[model samples]
Target chain A: MIRFDNVTKRYAGGHEGVSEICLEVDAGELVFLTGHSGAGKTTLLKLLALIERPTRGQVLLNGRNVGRLPARAIPEHRRGLGMVFQDHKLLPDRTVFENVSLPLIIAGLGRREIARRVRAALDQVGLLSRESSRPDALSTGEQQRVGIARAVVGRPRLLIADEPTGNLDPDLSLEIMMLFRRLNGVGVTMLIATHDLALVQELGGRRVILEGGRVSGEQD
Target chain B: MRLWLTRHVQNCLAAMGRLVQRPAGSLLTIAVIGIALALPAGLNVLVRNGEVLAGGWESARDFSVYLKPGEELAQAATLAKSLSANSNVDDVEIISAEAALADFQQSGSFEGALTGLDNNPLPHTLVVRPRPEAPASELAELARELGKDTSVDQVRLDTEWVERLNAILEFVRRGIWLAAGLLAIAVVVIVGNTIRLDIENRRAEIEVAKLLGATDAFVRRPFLYTGFWYGLGGGLFALVVVLVGLAVLGGPVARLSALYGASFQLQGLAGSGALTVLGGGLVAGLVGAWFAVSQHLTAIQPKI
Candidate 1:
């Protein structure tokens, strides 16, 4: 469902965030990006979300060239994909339910439908009991799960994450990884960026390795 | 359609909730907006009151034509008859020189001073009251024409005070409009700055919202509602200020009018006037919020 043809993103001051990155992942396929810090993993994901544009070459999503999406169309492009962050990105002031329901609210879903879908997503993430609790009250792992619940509440077919397990302990990280595997079992495509090679092997997915802002290797 | 309404309702409530959460800042911003809005509204109401007070005396369109000394009472009588025949002239009362002297001498000190005179020096005077419906220019033209007559030495309009008062009122009215326009800009700036600070404080929330597939409009809805509330609140507060001012001044104004030989009631804002002040505040608030969000929202992309 995704393709990048030699995409290059060069920041100002001649620093390359990502360069000459040609990649592809088939629909419903789960792929892990393995790299150290500043290896351009986040930049690659950002290109897909149109958060940052490629300085050269084409980036295609499904069959459409999305590298040059007009400013007005960026939101619609993003709405089709679920995104999770390492920081959880939950509003501390709001209830966990409100955090998860944000995407549906943006999509203009009815209030009842929002409640139903939010409950279902929360149930999936094992956060069903903490819906009314604010993010600060939830454990770090629970907060990450809340983020995952939010990402999936819209029922988007594609999901992307930038180091989703970066902040959790190994036990919690394994639980979150299993959660991703469980989601993949049901036909959701995912591109996850991470630095844990052993866990990448444990998850048993195709791993694309990045080094010095370029894709260095691929292993199945 | 229902979903749209529900979403908007939620957004408005959320905006209000945010404002309520930060009571001190919100109240300060609102107080500034209220005072800004009240300045122009209060001034406009005062101008209305001035117009009402001025209304009493502007209609005094009377004048006196003093005939030349040595003019016979018969000549003055004939002059008054001709003036009365003019369509603009409502009525003219002829005061013979002998009658003028006797009326003047009846007043105490003036009689003592004029006892040395062998003959009455007061000239024959014609007190002319013009038609009430006569336009100002028409009345001035009639006075000029009367002064040109050889029988008349001077044509003195008693309503000159009214003209001077009208000029001062018009000037003040213009000044109020200029001040209102300036203060309108001030209101917009105040709101814009407040919204900008609000956006900065909620920067993380905005980044998260945008990352979660929220559009600019989706992210902006709350701020817009905040502005809407600010404007609506400011407008309401301005109405309060105006009413309070009217109440405080009402008694003194009535007494002042009484001293002037008239009983005047102070009129507060009419319905339309209140609406106008409210509407202006709403527009300014919305505009300020729009500019603030448009300029700053895009600058805050979720940095990877």
Candidate 2:
């Protein structure tokens, strides 16, 4: 479902975010992307999400060159993939239900369908009772759960999470990782970027390691 | 089809709810717009009333032609008859010197003022009324033509005040247009600033929405609707202000007209006029909102 052919992204100051990175992940595959700070893990995921364009070479998703996607098609393209950020990115002013309903709302879903899907997503995240509570009022883990619920609520075929467990304690982090494993067991493809090698080892997933601006190794 | 309508209605309601949530700020903006609209509308009513009053003085457009001293009454009568037959002349009345003296005597206040004269001092005069549709310039031309006649000493038209009134009315009309235009721009600026602040306050929410796949148009919908509501409310308020102004002036205007032996009524806005005011408000609001959102929304993309 994803392929990168010698993709290179360079910043304005001549710093290389990622260089000549060639990678592929088949459909329905769950993979971990591990790297140290500034190792281009976030930049790599951003390229796949079409949030940033590759400075060279081609980035393909579902057999289509994403770098050539028109500006008007960006939202439509994004709607097909769920994305999670380390900060949760939940709207502080919105309730948990509203936060989760954002994706379906953008898709122009009917109110009844949005409500139904939002409740189910919240239920999956185990925050069904806090649906009406504002994100700021929720605990850090709960807010992260709301963010996950938002991402999966759209039923996207691919989920790209950038350090989803970065802000959580080890216990909560494990719980969140277990949640990702359960989602993967149900055949939802996921590519998670993290620096936690021990957690990757514990989860026992295929790992793609980045060092400096290049993919250093791959392990299964 | 129903779903589209439902979403639009929901968006409109949501916009209204946001305005209502901050009632004081919204009300102040609306009141400013209302006052701006009312000024021009009230001036327009004054212009209308001036036109009506000018129409009532149409008969005063006639000319009084005074024949040269020693001209015969018979000559004046013949002149009046000839003027009456002219296509431009509606009618002509001839007043002999005897009749003029008799009119002056009947006024009582001027009873003996003219008695010392051995003969009547007043000359034979012909009052010439032009066609009712005659323009002031055309009537002035006719007056100049009459002055060329050897038998006439002077031709005096009582239309000077009417001309001055018309000039004043024109000046006022242009002033009203200028005021209206400036106020419209003010409305746009006011609404644009308000929308800008709203966007700023909701910056984080907007960024989150965009990240969640919301299009620029989808994000802009609520702010546009907010502008719509503001314009609508402002227009209605302006209409009320104008109507109440007319009502307050109506009684005094009627009394003044009665003193002049005339009946006059203040005219309020008809159905179409009210609609126009409301429509103007809506358009200004929509345009202002569009400008604000388009400028600020692009700058608010999620940083990723």
Candidate 3:
């Protein structure tokens, strides 16, 4: 569950990242955030991730005020929600398995347990065969799937992704979208930000559109 | 507990792997630390050898108490017995004036010159050997006490060389400690600089780890272990340097001592001294790594 009631974030140079925004999503829902460039989608996701705080009003997660969370508690909060970035953010020096195992490792799982969960998550992302292959050897879509596997390895209830398919071809993007649909079928709440309007139309999910740092419209 | 220990083991191995990835750089850093530590270690060993050689010469320090001319031989013998009873005095022997004159006549080429004299000019003397462990100050005190006797003319103690050697040794010991302190700071600095560069090179990896919800402590663990390895290697290498130095000097020293008609052996650091060197290196490495990690890790949060 999530709630953002009239939250505004302003940068130090007097640039408003998001202004007087209001949004909410019930549990077990998959929502797509779409807008043009500088539409404040990334800023909204950052507030949810606690990477940036709202300048005014409040951002809540399951009725808890995350805008008020202290710096020391940010790590634990981030760990509770899985995050996927547009660039995949995979360590190029490590193998795909090692990259995916990172979240479970941070959670301090035992070696056997970590191995088991990493294999299962990689299987879900169709990256099981490329476990020992380094990220540099993988294609763009596979790298993004590796990132998805890493985010979901710890079985977080809520997942937030920023431009997950921004680097993929149309066919690869549709494959990745199907992967998200499968995850949502398993009751993992998903909030994905993207500007891919065609994919949004094809997916036929609840959509929130942002324009100039404000929620301009919504479609069901 | 099991998971925590497992993570530590993983981090330690990971650190070792990273070091091995750049073997030349790691070994060079270790060697610098070894030589830096070896300077003080070698100096300490040499000082100890000097003390041993001085200790051999120290036992000969003694006192010569001269009785007044024409003093009775019997009174001189009684003075020797009383002086021997003091706790500080190890032994005392009285030499009668007649015996002294005869010995002087045989040892010197002045027998004919001495026979021309009507009477023996030598006075009864007591040879006093103080306890081996007695300090120079205590020896001086005993000599002063002997001079207070009515039959005693002059008390002469041969302790100048002993006092001078002790003072020199004290000065060298303090100098070595000062050098050791400054060099210790150098070791810490060397390790800190190494770790700082390591953090810089791994900036991207650190950012990814932090974004994956890795705590600062988790990011710091591997760097600390790398420091630990560097310190440990340097410590062992320093001990090796000292041992080899002692070995090279040992043969020439023994030959020199043989030329002097004395058999002296070169001594290296004892167990406790070696332990101190190793412990100092380890602590320095850990502290240096800690400073670098704390200063640099906080500045490297995920910027997205």
| Best candidate, lDDT | 3
The segments of candidate 3 whose C-alpha lies over 4 angstroms from its true place after superposition are B72-124, B130-138, B141-145
| Stronger candidate by TM-score (1 vs 3) | 3
User: How does residue A189 of candidate 1 score in lDDT?
Assistant: 97
Global lDDT of model 1: 0.89
Per-model tally of clashing residue pairs: 0, 0, 0
Q: Which of the two, 1 or 2, has more TM-score?
A: 2
lDDT of each: 0.89, 0.89, 0.91
Candidate 2 per-residue lDDT over residues B132-245, each given as its tens digit: 666778788888888999999999988989889988999999999999889888888889999999999999889878777788889999999999998999898899999999
Q: What is the per-residue lDDT of model 1 for residues A122-191, given as tens digits with 9 covering 90 to 100?
A: 9999989999999999899999999999999998889999999999888899999999989988899999
User: A118, model 3: CA deviation in Å?
Assistant: 0.7
Q: What C-alpha lDDT, on a 0 to 100 scale, does residue B242 get in candidate 2? A: 93
Query: lDDT score, residue B245, model 2?
Result: 93
What is the C-alpha DockQ of each candidate? Answer: 0.68, 0.63, 0.70
Q: What CAPRI class is candidate 3?
A: medium
* Residue-level lDDT tens digits of model 1 in B72-160: 88998898888889898889999888888888888766977789898888999998887766666888988898889988899988777
The better-scoring model by lDDT among 2 and 3 is: 3
